[model samples]
Target: MNVTIIGGGAWGTTLAQALTDNSHSVLIRDINEAFVEKINKRHIHPFFDIVIPTSIKATTDLDEALDFSEIIVLCVPTKAMRSVLVDINSKLTSKKLFINVSKGIEPETSKRVSEIVNEVIKKKYFGGYVVLSGPSHAEELILRKATALVAASVLKKNAKDVQELFANEKYLRVYTSDDVIGVETGGAIKNAIAIVSGVAFGLGLGENARAMLITRGIKEIVSIVVALGGKMETAYGLSGIGDLIVTASSMNSRNYQCGLRIGKGMGVEEAVGSLTQSVEGIRAIVAGYEIGKKYNLDLPIISAAYKVVNGQCSAKEALTSLLGRSLKEERYW
Candidate 1:
């Protein structure tokens, strides 16, 4: 199958390598001329040290990419989702399956990527929307390390189709889920928690505190998932708890790294600007805070994270605030 990936960043370049390994022809559309030339001319990923397959190609033209294949894999961030979809809709000539690899709720609407797709794409041109998310990171995927991800959609067939497209017996595995709401909610909500986990570690609070944050963090994730009409069980599955464990604990996560910088005394703007990648956790913090208010859910961690990231309080102050809350029974179920 021919696949067109719309972004040429780390994740986009990483997926291009995976697709080529599966013997699928890939065309990546990115706005950076040097990045596009590097891939097309040298067959090298701009962000990683690994060399890409000669079979993989990239271009700067969105129209050419939209016409290249029926399978459109979106690797861009949530902030760029709407503009990219509007461009695709203008040039869409046939029904297309959108496989979104980005995670995070839109700050303006707090809508998931699937919702944004439906709002922008024409119904006649929309075939399906599948969200691919999990504990997998781009850095590991580039090395063909063992990775598992969930392909979720309301349509089971769409989910399975994605599973077949990315799954393999070697280093990558894909699971299908009909709980799109649960998968997307879990994927988005975990970013906020990951930031808090980073802050905990930056403060030199040992593994005990990290474990506590993750354990309590699962409750916050479930609350948002249930409020969003997602299944409670899905919160414990790969896209939910699985994703949280990986993202919140690792240095590979951009969100965690951002929080670490903030905890170590860097300003939020400077901490975020230091990373070459998009820090989805910052926006996820804001979106999660708003969702909590809209649904009237008690999300202490998310609220504290919001305050820290927004400059309303220092990391230590936020930690103190969290600890000062009235003691309550542990209710994870």
Candidate 2:
């Protein structure tokens, strides 16, 4: 199968290598001319200092990329999703299967990438939407390290199709799920929790604190998933607790790194600005706070993260607020 990947960034190029490894043709479309040239001429990752497969090609033209294949892999950030979808809609000529790889919810609207795709893309040109999310990071994935992911869609066939497209015997493994909401909710909420975990670590909190945050983070994720009309079991699966465990505990996660800086006395904005990559946790914090309010749910971790990001409280103050919450039954729905 031939696929066109939008946004030739870290994850995008990494997946391009995966596709080529599976004997599929891959074309990457990125706005950065230098990135395009690097991929096309040097066969190297734009952000990472690693060599990529020479079979992979890149272009700056969205129209050409849209016309290159029937399968479209979207790897851009959530903030750029709507504009890119609108651009694709204008030039889309036929039915296309959209595989969303970005993990985030829109700030005010709390819309997932799938929802944004449905709202922006014309129905006639839309084939299906599949979200591929899990504990896998692009840094590890580029090294062909062992990773597991879930391919989720309301359309089971679409999920299965993606399962086959990216799955391999040695390193990459994909499971299928019909619970799109659960998978998406898990993927987005984990980023926010990872930041809190970072804050815990940066404050010189021991492993016990990291464990507590992850356990509570799972509860928070489950509540949000249920509120969003997804299965509770999905929260414990690969995209939920599995993802949170990896993201919140690792230095490789940009979200965790951002929190580390904040815990070490840097301001939230400055910490976020210091990273070269997009920290989805900031947006996830805002969305989670709003979602908690909309559903009238108790989300202490998310609330603290929101306060820190919005400049209402210091990182340590946020931690204090979380610890100061009244004791209650450990019931997690």
Candidate 3:
């Protein structure tokens, strides 16, 4: 299938590179003119030495990218999804599959990226929709690490197109799921938990604490997932279990690193400014809280995360508060 990735950030750049070598006609769109020029000239994003291809056409025009496109990959940052979709709303034509690789929730709407798109991106004009998510990290994928991911879509053919298009030995292993809601929710919620674990690490907490947090976090997040109409089992699959493990444990995770800074006594704005990349957890934690309120669910950990990042509580206090919460039966209802 012909593909156009809708953002030219790190993940988008890596994906374009991977697909171009496979004989796919790939186009990448970015609002940044410098990014477009750099990729066309150097086959790399100016931010990093990315392994992109000269043949992978890069443009600043969404209309240009959408033209001759059968698959639209939503590769923008999680927080940027809404504004970008709103801008591209009129351009989304029918018969194309939309694949989201971004991971987080829409803060104001408490909607996953796909949900935001579905609500705003008039699907009747598009070819199709899909979500590609899993343990795969952009940096690791660029380095050609063996990565496993799922391409979830409401339409089976879109998922299969992604699977057949992305599978290879060097990079981007693909799987498919019709449970797009579950896969999308799992991908968004796990980053919030990863921030909690990262705070645990930065506070000099031991593995016992981090491990317990990570494991129980599974239960905590799964509750919200099932309550929101997602499959309980998807939480255990690549989009769920796979992503949670990677985000919570890896130094490469912006969310994890952001939490570490907060745990070390830095302010949220300061920590966020220190990093060049946007962290998904900053938005995910807040969205998780908003979601909890709408669903009337008790999410102590996520609640504490909101407090910690906003400076309402210190990391130690947040951890203590979580431990001090009222006890209840461990149920997954």
Candidate 4:
């Protein structure tokens, strides 16, 4: 299959390499001309240590990327998805599939990536849309490490096509599901937990504290997911608990780092400035807060995360409040 990865960031470029290895022709498009030039000429994304094959075409033009590829792997971040989808919608014919790898809710509407795609499709032409998400990250995928991700679509056939698209011995293990709500929810909620875990690490809290927080974090996430029309079981899968474990435990997670900075007594603006990449949890917490309110979900952790990020509360205050919560039964069920 001919594929276009419509972003030039690490995830997009990394996926381009994976698709190329799968014996599919891959092209990557970046809005940044420097990133485009670097990938086209050097075959390596400047953000990573790995090198991609020069055979993968990298360009800045959307039309050029769309011209040959039938399946577009939308790897851009959530904030950029709207404009990018709008640009691509007119050009998309009925024959193509779009697989979203980006994770985060649209800030204005608090819609998931799949929702955004559905909205795009509703507004104009029809196209196959699916969201491929899980604990797998760009770093692991690019290195060809063992990884598994869900191929989620509203239509099972579209999910099946995505499963076939990336299933391979060299790169990824793909699972198909019509549970798009669960899959997308798992991807979005994990980042907030990761931020909390980051704060624990920065505060010199032991692994036990982080572990406890993460386990409870999963419970909070499951509540919100169920409240907002996602399956509780989905949170236990790769995109759910799997994602929580990876993002919360790893230093590579930008959200985790952002939390760490806040825990260390730095302001949100200061923390954001110190990091080069955008910390998506900053946006996700805000969206999650809105979702929690709209759905009447008890999401104290998500609320705390929003307060810390938005400067309404300090990280220390957030942690203290979490620890001082009213006694409740601990039910694993």
Clash count for each candidate, listed in order shown: 0, 0, 12, 0
Point to the candidate with the largest TM-score: 2
**Candidate-wise lDDT, in order:** 0.91, 0.93, 0.83, 0.81
lDDT at residue 37 of model 2 (Cα atoms): 96
* Tens digits of lDDT, candidate 1, 1-333: 999999989999998888888889999999889999999999888788678888889999988998999999998888888998999899999999999999889988999999999999999999999999989888899999999999999899999999998888889999999999899989998999999999988887879988988989999999999999999999999988999999999999999999888888889899999999888888899999999999999999999999987789999999999999999997876
Residue pairs with colliding backbones in model 4 are: none
What TM-score does candidate 1 reach? 0.98
Give me the overall lDDT of model 3: 0.83
Listed in order, each prediction's TM-score against the native is 0.98, 0.99, 0.94, 0.95
Give me the overall lDDT of model 4: 0.81
How far is 295's C-alpha from truth in model 2 (Å)? 0.4
Global fold similarity of model 2 (TM-score): 0.99
After superposing candidate 1, which stretches have Cα over 4 Å from the reference? none
Better candidate by lDDT, 1 or 4: 1
Please report the TM-score between candidate 3 and the true structure: 0.94
Tens-place lDDT digits, model 4, residues 1-333: 788888868777877777778788888888888888887777776588567888888888877888877788888878888988888876665455778888888868989887788777544345678988888767777889989989888898899988887888765888988788888877887888888888878887889988998898898778877877788888888888988998998877888888788788888778867886656777778888898899887888888888887788878888889889999999743
Show where candidate 3 strays beyond 4 Å: 92-95, 326-333
